[model samples]
Target: PLQLSQHRVREKEAVKQSGVKTAKVKGVKNLEEIKKAIDEIGYPSILKTCSGGYDGKGQWKLLEEKDVKSINWNENVEYILEEMIRFDKEVSCLVVRGINRDIVSYPIGENSHKKGILNKTIVPARVSKDILEKVEKTSQEIRKRLD
Candidate 1:
């Protein structure tokens, strides 16, 4: 088997919600905090999993944060959560380093969704010249953090 130490990707991807009150999502320890986030983010903000939230699966597009207000507290559990941002483009870029210290980057992909499910992917996305610059710049920032 290939020597693998750690290749896990921890994600907290957010959509751009310009007018949304992001501070409303203060902490993510228990039900109360989650409820507060709902109250603040309102419905349809994607909530991602901290670990088990595989590829945004545990994610929910809540329509009303108060939806939790109506549910009885069965347990003090919460999904690892965040407020989803609305972005014109959703993409993923990966950088891999082999034991040989060789680094490779998979081509960036332009993503699409169907019923909240990832549907299609276009590698080497055909974005506008202007948007392409923005994507490259943003991807660079993310790579820096991962390093």
Candidate 2:
């Protein structure tokens, strides 16, 4: 279900949402285009395989343009160049929305994954009150979007 065009378009949204001034490869196809794409995106863009790959899987972070060829990418498979989403920690939120349209929000919980599989959840997140409110509000917004 990964549409090539859609992924490229979404990358822009991701870049803007991140609010980080980073470059991205715009629609790369072959080696020649990849090289050009990398030039546009600049170095340190994550070369992400945009299929069903997930949870840090099928992703490669290329720091330099020269190393782009070393990655064994299928000529047909398009790659999405994404800016690295860095943070002090990564967390997940679970919000329950009942069939009756009732919403119950859980506290944002820290998460740990092994080989891309979620392993455990740590509640009572040890983040600042401000950060907690920001994350919590974001989680609620995400749930609303999904609803």
Q: Pick the candidate with the highest lDDT.
A: 2
- The digit string of per-residue lDDT tens for model 1 on 25-118 reads 3335467677676666665655544434444465556556565555443344344445556668877666677889786777778888886778
lDDT tens digits, residue span 1-147, model 2:
123224654545454454434444465556787677776767677776656556677677678866786888688786677655556766766778778989887888887777655677788777788878877776666445434
- Candidate 1 accuracy as lDDT: 0.54
Counted clashes in each candidate structure: 8, 0
Q: Rate the local accuracy (lDDT) of all candidates.
A: 0.54, 0.65
For model 1, how big is the CA root-mean-square deviation?
6.2
Clashing pairs in 2: none
Cα lDDT for residue 109, model 1? 82
